[model samples]
Target: MKRITVIGSGYVGTAVACLLSTKNMVAVIDTDKEIIHKLSKQISHLDDPQIKKYLKKNKNNLKFSTELTSAISKTDLYILCLPTDFLVSKNEFDTKNLKSVISELTELDPKVPILIKSTVPMHFTDEMNKEFNRDDIVFSPEFLREGQALYDSFYPSRIIFGSKKPSLATKIASIFKEAAKNSPQVLFSSAAESESIKLFSNSYLAMRVAFFNELDSLCLSKSFDAKKIIEGVCSDARIGNEYNNPSFGFGGYCLPKDTKQLISQFKDIPNSLITSVIQSNEKRKKYISNKIIEKKPKNVGIYRLQMKEGSDNFKESSVINIIKKIKNHKIPIIIYEPLLRKQTFLNSKVMTNFTEFAASASIILANRYNEELNPYLEKTFTRDIFQEN
Candidate 1:
């Protein structure tokens, strides 16, 4: 079995480390003691139930540690899954975490291949290789949903490796293929092309979301049944029924940032549709905010701060922007998010009791509909026509 060291214990890192551990001697390294401690006890730090189940059954093949130096000894391969959030000012991803880990790993001068599973800008792998005078770095992007990370890893839509060495790429691909339950299509390409693939793929998904949201906006303006229209359009078979459900806009860890980063990459390249996708999401959010404002409610209750069900992340959530717009109109806001421990969020009062939260607001805004909100459907505002994410 190949000795693998996976850096970081976040969602991507945890899922990948677990997947690789199925056939390899894998050590999952993280700086957080709490995360390492939990992993040692076969507990997951993330919200994915599949990961929790996998960890319980696969603990024998995995090693959890906070010390990177100890974990790296005699490692056959290293996979980096560090965060690289997009920076609006620079119009690029802030890859400081990846750079720091790479610098430390290269300083050790280990003769092992390094796989980057983190999302990065175009030519990032080549730039790192040239800077460090190493040719062992490879870029492999991940396409995992927040709460379904492990399940997706077990049955990935595709597996791709971007490297200069064909033999090394093949070896790595074989390892991942062994872990997956299905035979996913595997592609090998240049590092830059792989990076572009990730950005373009996410941007395209965002475009689809925007297209439907704009359609919903038009339907709302004319009192047309968006559900019927969407159903009819998707029946063409080419359109397909997946990802057709509309929401406030496309917002999560990936789509918003990736689409914006893709737009930045097109600064010199001629493109109108790419930029419009970002604008369209913004327009959809404003349209939603105005609809809420038109009701003139005394207090607007936000059902959840999460982007979707079973997810704890609210960063870049569409409702956040909608909240900011609603606040400008001087309307009091009450948020009913159990995830928030604080009494206040975004300068709005947070209510823990669902009944009290529901009773206090004149109207509730839900981006994604839930069964609990069925009792208050008349006062609820949402665009979740399909009731699925």
Candidate 2:
């Protein structure tokens, strides 16, 4: 079995480690001691069920460590899955963490082929290769969803490798393909093209989300049947029927940052739709906030802080934006999220008891409808027409 080293133990890293460990000896390294401790006990820090199962079953082949030097020394194939958060002030991605990992690896002189699974700015991989004076680095974009990361990794839609060396690209693809249950289509292209593919792909999905949210906004203003209109429009074969569900906005780890990053890359280029997509999402959130304000509830009860179901991530979540807007209007608010252990969030009281939370607020704002809110459906305000996340 191939000895593979995966850096980072977040969503993408954990999923990749679990998938690869089924057939290869995988070492998962992260700076967080608590995450390392959890993984060492065959416990997954991520919320993905598939990842937890795989980690439990494949503990024999998987290794967890906080020491990067030791892990890199044992494996020739390295995968970097570090975070590259988008910085709004700089209008660029903060890739310092990724760069640090690469720097550490270079110092250790593993000299092995390194594959980047993190989403980065266009031409970043190529520039990094030149900066390090190494051609063995590759960029392979990951398209796994937050809640179903491992499931998506085990059955990828497509595999694209960005590498100048065909032999090394093939070897990287082989490892993923052998681990994946489905024989996905594999494509090799330049690093720049691969980066553009990732940015454009997520931006397109964001655009679709904006389109549906705008449609919902119009229906709300004109008092039209949004569900009927969506049904009729999506019935067209050309339009298809995916990503049409409406929410507060397209706020998640990928969509918001990717859309903004794509817009930032459009410098000197004539583009209207790309820039407007970002604006539309912001407008959608404001509209949702105003609608809640019109109700003039005693206290606004937030059903959940997460962006979607089965996910614990609240970073860049649309509901949080809605909460801020409501707070700005001098309205009292309470949050009900089981995932949060703290009694307070952003200066607002967090209700651990569901019954108390539901009873305190005269009206509730739910981004996505859930069955638990059924008894209080009349008091809930939501734009979830399809009841899907």
Candidate 3:
């Protein structure tokens, strides 16, 4: 079996390691001792059911460690799943961590192939290959969601490899193909094109979200039924009713940052739609906040902090933005999130007792509807048209 080392045991890396361990000897390396400790005991650090099952079933083939050097020495191939968070102040992605990982691996072994699964700016892979003087540095963008990471990996819609070495690219594709349950279309293209594919793909999803949200806003203003309008509009086969759900805005780990990164790339070129997508998302959040302000509640109750259902991530969740806006009005807010251990978040009180939280607020704001909020439906304000995240 092929030996693989996956670096960065976050959402993407953990899922990749579990999926590959089924047919290959995989070692997961991370700087976090707690993450390594949990993985070593066959316990998943992330909140994916599929990952938990696979980690348990493939415990014999999978290994976890905090020692990167030792893991690299034992592995034949390296997959870098490092973070590249977009920095708003710099108007670009902070790729320092990814560059550091590449430097370490090149020093360890220059001949071993390295596949970059981290999201980087366009032409980043090409520049890095030229800098290191190696062609085996491939850029394969990940398309997995936050909670459904392993499920998407097991049944990927497409597999793309960005490499100058066609033979090496084919071999890398073969490895993923062998691991996946279904035969996904594999495409080998230039590093720049592949990078553009990821950015544009996420940007399009953000745009669709913005489009439906704008429609909902117009319907609300006109006192029309948004659900009926959306149903009739989505009836067109070309539209194919999906992702038409309204929310505070499109805020997640990928969409917000990826769309901003793509806009940064349009520095020289004149474009309105690309720039408007970012503005539209912010406007949607502001519109939602304005609706909350119109209610003029003494205390507002936030049902959950997550961006969507089955996800523990709240990095850039739209509900957080709404909370910030509402805070500016000097209104008391209490958050009810079972996942939050802290008593206070962002200077607002976090209520562990759901009954007390519900009684304290005159109105509640929920980005996505849940059954737990059923008793307080009359006091709850939500824009979840499809009732699914």
Candidate 4:
């Protein structure tokens, strides 16, 4: 196995770092000194219990640090798993991290094949190659849930590389393939085309979510059972019945930004719904907040701010947006997040004790339903159609 280095050390980077450590000597380079210190001790800053276990088991091969020189000097392959957040106002993804990592990698070592695992603006790879004067860099997107990052790494549905050098791409793909639990789809392409593939893929999933959400919205408006309609529609084999669950909106690290980035790419193009889908998500968040507000509650409790179960991410969690919505409306907010060790969330009281939160809340707004709040089930307001999200 070849030596591997992962930059960023967030969810994606951490997952990739741990997974590669199973077969290769892996060192994660992060600017976050605290995170580096934790990883250095074979401990994960993440709340996931499984993550810590993996860190313990793979302590021999896994190492982490804040030094870029040591990282670049140690590994021939560097994975740039930096943040590529959506620029909401700009309607594009901020590829500043990817750009900076590529430049840094070149300054460190020109021969290292850096695989960009961060999502980017379409044609980013094309422009980057021209700017940096390197053909060794490649774009390989990651598809991982926040909480199940490592598990997904071991069982990735696909491993795609955006490199014209099919032979070299195959070598990179082989690294992930050996570590993967199942057969992974390894496809090669021009960096520009691959970047488009990642954006368009997420956009399509976002569109699917929006489609089902509108269906739920229509059902709610007409007092029709959403479960019945969804069941009937998904009964068709053509639909395949995945990503069909409805929610306040699609808000995570990827979908929300990816859809907007793709829409921005269509600047001169004639499109209405593509743009409307983005608008609809915002409208949906507002609409849900309004619906919860009509209850005339005194103190509202937020039960689990996670985007979905088994996911530790809340980067653009819809529930946090709900908190922002109710803050100025005179209703005091308390949050019950098992993942949090803080006394508060943003500014709202963080109730580690469910009993206190449950007793004080006039109503609880959960983006996704959880049975843990069953003691105050009557006070809960959620649109969990299938109770899956």
lDDT of 3: 0.90
Please identify model 3 stretches exceeding 4 Å from their true place. none
The lowest-lDDT stretch of 10 consecutive residues in candidate 1 is 104-113
Candidate 1 vs 2: which has more TM-score: 2
Better by TM-score, candidate 4 or 3? 3
What are the Cα lDDT values of the candidates? Answer: 0.91, 0.91, 0.90, 0.83
Global lDDT for candidate 2?
0.91
Clashes of each: 0, 0, 0, 0
Q: Can you give the lDDT of residue 197 in candidate 1?
A: 96
Q: Which ten residues in a row have the lowest lDDT in candidate 3?
A: 67-76
Q: How accurate is candidate 1 locally (lDDT)?
A: 0.91
Models 1 onward score TM values of 0.97, 0.98, 0.98, 0.95
lDDT of 4 by residue, 239-274 (tens): 977779888888887888888788889898888877
* lDDT of candidate 2 over 84-104, digit per residue (tens): 899988999999889878877
Off by over 4 Å in 2: none
User: Which residue pairs collide, candidate 2?
Assistant: none
Q: State candidate 3's TM-score.
A: 0.98
Question: 212-306, model 3: which lDDT tens digit per residue?
Answer: 99999999889899999999999999997998999989998889999999999989898888789889999999998988888888989998898
